[model samples]
Target: MFGYVIKRHQLWSGKVLLFPLSSSCASGASGVRFVFGRASAAGTERRTAPAESTGQGEAMYRRKMRGMYISKRALRKHFDPHNYPRETYLLCELQWRGSHKFWQHWLRNDDSKDCHAEKYFLEEIFEPRSYNICDMTWYLSWSPCGECCDIIQDFLEEQPNVNINIRVARLYYTDRASNRKGLRELASSPGVTLEIMDAEDYNYCWETFIQPGVYYRFSPENFESAIKRNCSQLDDILQGLHL
Candidate 1:
């Protein structure tokens, strides 16, 4: 996950300064577009301002600024959809020895890219660590499937130093007996913690990591209700299987 903060310039011209908060993006950059209005005012219009320099300096600066703006906007637009309805993507945040790392991976149902998020985490992040203890928290748009459960179960059995905490948008279960058994197995894991994500968790991730500028207005009570509803349905399915 990536985010940027905006800095406003104190100008008497009533124009608000907006710049990409990233260091790499801000390097060698000049003036950006300014909005002429009060901070509390609505529908403020933005107007382009001339670069502070000309010739090679202006051209190179604009090129870098444009690339950063386009890339940041494109990433937000492309990944925002994956966090809902589709539930095909997963993001992991790892905290170890006062350092934090993030990894985002997606799973496709039929394609060769059917790699699981856990496998990616193990191969990319966990393998490189020299420390023995690490805490891994997963922000999954959908719960793990049966195959994923088996893979993670084997992993935890081998690596006792890792602790996993999973917060998911929704559960994915079926009427199949194997699926139900898998869910039970995953829930019974000793070193792993799993739960439906609450609004606080959602808001924290949204503000601190995903999109710093946008506020997530979802309520914790509503999220709890959704979890209850999903649990009720899962209970009915499990009762039908008599397991």
Candidate 2:
């Protein structure tokens, strides 16, 4: 869930950014290093004399830059494992929205079907046979827990990977409001640190913690952006992350 578009500089320097994938370690030092594989042809320089250069042999220096230097947000599409095996994940809020019938139809479809995208994504992104997927309706506070927590806890208990991710489906307008309640619950939990974002005070957040490199899945216009904008100071724990 913490996946992000890393800053352009780190992308250029070929440094693997680290992020806290597990709740237990989320509050501690950089959780783990998810290294970005380096670009080829590092430091290979070439120089050409200026066309206007006098008898003096003045050369302009240039280095061959290997690897596509796309923007941070675009990295996921450019380097997706399905598309590019040696790929890393980017930030996204995956919501599960359809009914059982929808999933039933999905389960019956082949890879070529449009509905198959969700199933394929789950298979590739989620730990195999580890978590139970479910859908729950939204409410004022902790509404998802009574019905959904079991499936979630079951998945967490089964998956041993420290680098775990939570995915949701079927995002709606009300979903944003639900997010606030859910995040509050998570933050109030024993070890969770809730980073609430208020839309009106967004600029304060951006200047506070979000480091230069990290970018959230929420668009610039989304309420979450305001929160990130104000909490930019949290960048102290975010820059140059690997996991």
Candidate 3:
């Protein structure tokens, strides 16, 4: 049997005694041997160590919370082009046969501190996926830039099993001849279909792929109006580019 004895009075009296009883000792035996020590007043007073707060740890926790909040907010505004009017946002929906569930990724121009969204997705999301037959549809607020166009071309060349369809709200064409040529080449790439999303396609993507539960007031009419406005803006830009 193992037991411990604590004497609070002895501790208060500036003396504490401890003794280990032998197995042969009876339950109610007296004359228990003990080691005694005199306690100082300072020693009797309890002191608790204060908790150490780390600035780096707190900063990291705050950053994590901020990232989660931003991601949640991004999900709600994924289909709304007004959130990042000047920048591009790409939302990819991946669906496989025999599965009702789908994997979705939202990539914004400034999502990463170092790399663009195309590189970020290629390195983080695409590299980790196992070989499977899946259809990937990309919904872009604006057509991919020249650099991203190249990346997509290379990715498609490597992953033949995965088919890609790109639907854009606005055409990405600049006065730069190289950019105009790259966009044309990308549109004509094999195993990839690139098209400007019509009103029906826009509504279908917003209602079916985006966070539909959060937007309770979302309607097809609103989506159609937004698509028409975006199309007009795209037309003006395209006309300016003369292509």
Give lDDT tens digits, candidate 2, residues 21-103.
23221111111112222211111112122222122111111111212222333332322212322222222211121111111
What lDDT would each prediction earn against the true structure?
Answer: 0.45, 0.24, 0.47
Worst 10 residues of 1 by lDDT: 53-62
TM-scores for all candidates?
0.54, 0.23, 0.54
The pairs that clash in candidate 3 are none
How well does model 1 score by local distance difference test? 0.45
Model 3 segments more than 4 A misplaced: 1-84, 97-100, 111-114, 128-131, 209-243
Compared with the true structure, what per-residue lDDT tens digits does model 3 show for residues 104-166? Answer: 445455432434555545543442223344456777767777788788778766765456777
All models, RMSD in angstroms: 15.9, 21.4, 26.8
What local lDDT does model 3 show for residue 121? 53
Greater TM-score among 2 and 3 belongs to 3
Best by lDDT: 3
As for candidate 1, its clashing pairs are none
Runs off by more than 4 Å, candidate 1 = 1-84, 97-112, 128-131, 214-224, 231-242
